[model samples]
Every structure is written in structure tokens, then in C-alpha cells.
Target chain A: MRYKVRELTDMQNSALKEIINIGVGNAATSLSKMIKHQISIDIPELRVEIIEKVPEAAGGADKVVSGVIMHVDGDINGYIMMLLSEDSAATICKAINEEEDTDIHTPMNQSMLEEIGHILAGSYISSLAEFLTLDVKISPPMQTFDMLGAIMDQILIEMSQNVECTLFFDTVFVLEGKQMEGILLTLFDPMGMDKLLGRIDEMT
Target chain B: MIIVGMADSAVAKKPEKLTTLGLGSCIGISLYDNRNCIGGMVHIMLPSVENARAKDNRAKFADTGIPDLVDSMVKQGAAKHHLTAKIAGGARMFSFSSNSNLNIGERNLAATKEVLDKLRIKTIADDTGDTYGRTIILDTETGQLTVKSAQKGEKRY
Candidate 1:
């Protein structure tokens, strides 16, 4: 029988959160090193929720932001995403380029954001793989600036087709002293989630 | 303003506006009847629900959602013949070399128009297909739709 996301036990739930925290923490480390700014991450949240509620749950659907998305392949299948507020995107851009301007729309700046996202995602997914002992690889990142819902609605649509519930794992992080924040989000399909839970079971 | 959410639909009459936010690849179809000043909006994720496992959510697909919205508008006193449609938000937000999921937006946009055509609803305005996101609001009184984006500014049609 397929294990539903909501069927996760309390122990499983906390374990899931811990796994996500490790992934986000790894990303935070990579980001802090690249930007040379202190990164502070909040406790990661892992929830199994209906697809329609995801946009509202993450943030308002219309909130404008910068987004970086990548598809995960190999042993696990899912999408890894980053959503940055305008302030966070600009602040990160400014730090990386050592420029006074804080714009992320410039071609060079956009690419920088993509690379940063790639590095962060690489670090994040590897930790997940290592902990679960699963082989995984990620596609090149696609970066865009748009409304939060617009940036991720397609992924939700694709996920919604197969299952009524989705795993929404997110962590909010800030660039210290700048007070600029961003969100790291990962969506694993139900089958992939089942595999993760199976691995977690083996460890226990 | 009433906000229609993904796989959700809403209907209203004069003085009440209908809006849908954060349309990346999903299509937002707005229907209006100027005679009665009735407006409706549906945020559809897929072109059809025929293949879906869950058939209960009619508002989640273009084939079922648009007709359902129209029927509800008629039930709310909007004349069917006078109904005109305005649509926005079918953006290819991200692209990958081999990923078909990213192309859902284009497919959604096409299916929406096809449904409207079959229903004989005149499509008065269309703002779709790009690499950005859009938020749209439909004014029931004027049947005007305002499309807003992060960097694209705003436009009404």
C-alpha cells in the first residue's frame, strides 16, 4: 500500500523536518560562503497539504519575487526551488558583484542568481541523498522574476495531477544585518516521498 | 474584490470585482455580462479533467470549469448571449530543454480559448504566453480586466 503523506507518524514527521533542515542548512552554508554574509535560517517546516492551498500557504499568490527552479532526477524525483523577495534578491546580487546597484534584472545579475541557486541546490540535495543513501542529480537552474504563484503554479499543477496532497518543505532565511529574506522550497512527488519514508524506516 | 484561487472559481454582480492572483502557467478566464454587470473568474490548472482521478473539483479544468462558471453566472441572472470573455495569465514561467511540465501553460492557454470558442463566447481580450507571471482583476461594472506583473507594469483590457 502507498503511504500517504498525512499518514506520517509523529516520529516520522519530526524526522522529515530534520532531514529538510539539514538540506536547507547545507544550502545556507553554501550561500553564506559565496556571498560572504552571515545567513540565518529558521526552523524548517514540513507539511502535507492540498495543492490548492500551497500558494496561499507559502505566501500570497500575487507577491512578486525572484525564483530559481530545478528538476531533480535519478533515484528521487521532484523540484527544488528558491523564492527571494526583491530586497533579498537585490541584496544578494549587490554582495556578489560588489556593486552599489541592487538590481537582479540585469542579464549578469540574473545569471549570478542562477549560479548561486545551483550551488545552494547542489549542496541541499546532496545532503538529502547522503542521509537517505539515494542517488540523485539536478538539472540546471531556470531563474525568473515574477509573482510567487506564477513562478511555481506549473509545478503544483503537475504534482496535483497525480496526488491530492503534496509535501511542502520550506525554510526561511535572512541575510544578517540586511534583514533581507528568502524561502527555500522543495516538492517531492508522492512516490519519491514514499521512498524517503522507506529509507527513514530502515534507519530506525 | 473576490479572489479566485487555483482550481477555484467565483461569480459576482455589479460593484463586486473578481480577481485571480499569481498566474504562472495557469490560465485565468474571466466572463462578464455587461447587461447584468455580472462577472466570473476561474483559475484552471489543466485543459481537461477527463483523465483526472478526482472529478469532484470541476473548477480545476478548462473543459468543466468554464461551463460550470457560465452556468452559475446564468443562475445568478447573467444572460448567456451577452456574455463576453477576457483572459490573462498563461506564462511559460520556466523552461527546461526536455521538460514537458513547463509547457503546461501554453497548453492551458490553448485549451481555454478552444472551450470559449465552442461555447460561442466572444473573447474580447487576451494577454498570455510569455516568460513572466501575471495577476488579473476583472471589474464587473465595466467588464475590464487589469493585468499586473512584477516588472511588466500593468495593463487593462
Candidate 2:
């Protein structure tokens, strides 16, 4: 049976949330180790949203951001993105490389930022696969720095061809007692999402 | 000024401006009739909708969107024969393995041209197929299109 995204039951939402909670937890741990500072991640928001509204979920359509894109394939197929505000990205970059003149737009900074995205986004998908007991492989991370709307436009266009809605997972990262917002978006194929919900139903 | 959202299109007459924000791999096609000072913009996400699993959103695909946009422009006093086109924002935001799906930027640009050709609309200028995202604006009075990007500041096409 096909499951309409809007018709998702509370139980199903909770189950999916639990799986993501685990994944986000794992990602936070890895981020902390990489930055050598205690990092706290709080994800109080997650939902399946229409493609047009997915960009708004991160903020406004025109907000500039730095992000990494990962493709999940194999038994399950979907896309995962880690979006950070310019300030947050710069902070993370500075923590990794303390060169006074290095900036986020520099080649050195770009590579470091991509590595940060790979480690965080990689752990996110791997943990979800473990919880679902599904064999999923993550593609190499693709890093981008541009308008928030532009980055999401690419993903939303891809998602719209496959599904009417996209799964949004958002969180906040606290570093050095400063709060920074993080958006982890997952856009699963329609059939894949239906299958995933079914698997979650069975496990529940 | 009117704002066009993703998978959407809009038309305007003289002195009015139409804009679309955040065009990454998606293509933004601007149609204008210099004789009538009428312009239209469509932000199409995919090349075609033949195998699309979702319900048909005409404005979301190049195949269906270009015709619909032209039809609307004609209804607003524009002559189809005089319509010229400018397109922007089919960008590959990432470099991945040779997956055609990830190469959506190129596909969208190609599809836009094919549709414009079928309609016989002359494409005067285009800024597309790069590794950056763009926001575009269309001025009906001047029939000029301005494309802006984070990497490349701004250019009028």
C-alpha cells in the first residue's frame, strides 16, 4: 500500500524521529571530536514538507549558506544535506584552521569545510542505516557555498521529480556556549519513503 | 514586481518586473515580446514529466511550462511571433560521480532550449551551466534580464 506523506501516523513519525535522533546524536559526537570542543546538538524539528516549502524550512529563500550534499544509495535511496549559516561555517572553519588570513572562500578553507561536512553527514546516514538494519551506502560529499535557496533549489528539483514532499530534519548546534542553527534535510524517493515507513511500522 | 516560486511561472506587462529567487540546477526561462513590452518567467525544475511519480505540476517541467508561459503572455496582449527569450540558472552545485541525475543543470538547460525551439521563440541570451547558483529578474519595460550569483556578482543578459 502506498503511504501519502501527509497521512503519516503519529507512531510512524515518532519511530522516524527516534531513528534520526540516534543518527544526529552520533553526528554530534563526531563533530565534537573533530573540533576538539564539546558540541551539543538539539533537534526539535523534523517533518515531511512539500518541495516548494523545503527551502523556507531552512530560513528564507535568499539567505546565503554553506552546505554539503550526500547521496544515500543501495537498499535505500535518498539525499542528505547539512546546511550551516555563514557565521557558523566561519566559526567551524576557524576552529579547524587558525590561520589569521584564511577565510571560508579560500581553497584551504573549502577543503576543510568539506571534510567537516563529510564526517558529520557521513555519521548521520551510517547511524540511520544501522538502526534500520538496511544496507545503504553514502556517496562522497559535495560541498557548496551559496544562497540557501539556490542550494536547496537543486535538491528540491530532484525531489520534485520523484516525490511531492521532502523530509526535513533540523537542529541547533551549541559550540563554546554560542548557538548556531543546523538543518539536516532528507529527500527520499516516494517509493523508498513508503518502504521505510513500512519497515518502521513493522519494527514498532 | 512579482515573485515566481519554484515550479512556478508569472507574466507581466510594461513597467512591471518579474523575479525568481534561488535557481540552482533548475532553469529560469524569461520570455518577452519587445513589441508589446510584455514579459514572463518560468522556473522549471526538471526537463520533462514523462516519468514523474508526482502529480503533474505543469510549471515544474520544461516540456509543459514553456508553452503555458507563452499562452499566458499572449493573453496579456503580447504577440507570440515577437517573443524573445533569455535563460539563466542551470548550475551544477556539486561535482559527483557520472550520475546523469546529478547532472540536472545540463539537462534542464538542454530541455529549455528544445522547448523554446519547438515554440520558435528566439533565445537572445543565456547564462547557464556552471558550478554556482543564481537569482534572476526580468524587466518588462526594457525586456532585460539580470542574473545574480554569489560567485559571480551580476550580469545583464
Candidate number with greatest TM-score:
1
Instruction: Give the poorly placed runs of model 1, Cα more than 4 Å off.
Output: none
User: What TM-score does chain A of model 2 get?
Assistant: 0.93
Worst 10 residues of 2 chain B by lDDT: B93-102
Give me the displacement of residue A100 in model 2, in angstroms.
6.4
Predicted candidate 1 versus true structure: per-residue lDDT over B1-157, tens digit per residue: 8989999999999999999999989999999999999999999999999888777899999999999999999999999999999998888877776567758988898899999999999999999998888999999989899999988899989
Task: Report per-candidate DockQ.
Answer: 0.85, 0.67
True contacts kept of 2: 0.73
Per-candidate TM-scores read 0.96, 0.93
lDDT of 1 at A68: 91
Model 2 chain A: lowest-lDDT 10 consecutive positions? A94-103
lDDT of each: 0.87, 0.83
Q: Indicate which candidate wins on DockQ.
A: 1
Please give the distance, in angstroms, between residue B149's alpha carbon in candidate 1 and its true position after superposition: 1.6
What is candidate 2's DockQ? 0.67
lDDT of 2 by residue, B1-157 (tens): 8999888899999899999888888889999999989999999988887877764689988999999999999998999999999999888887657344778888889999999999999999989987888889999999889998887799997
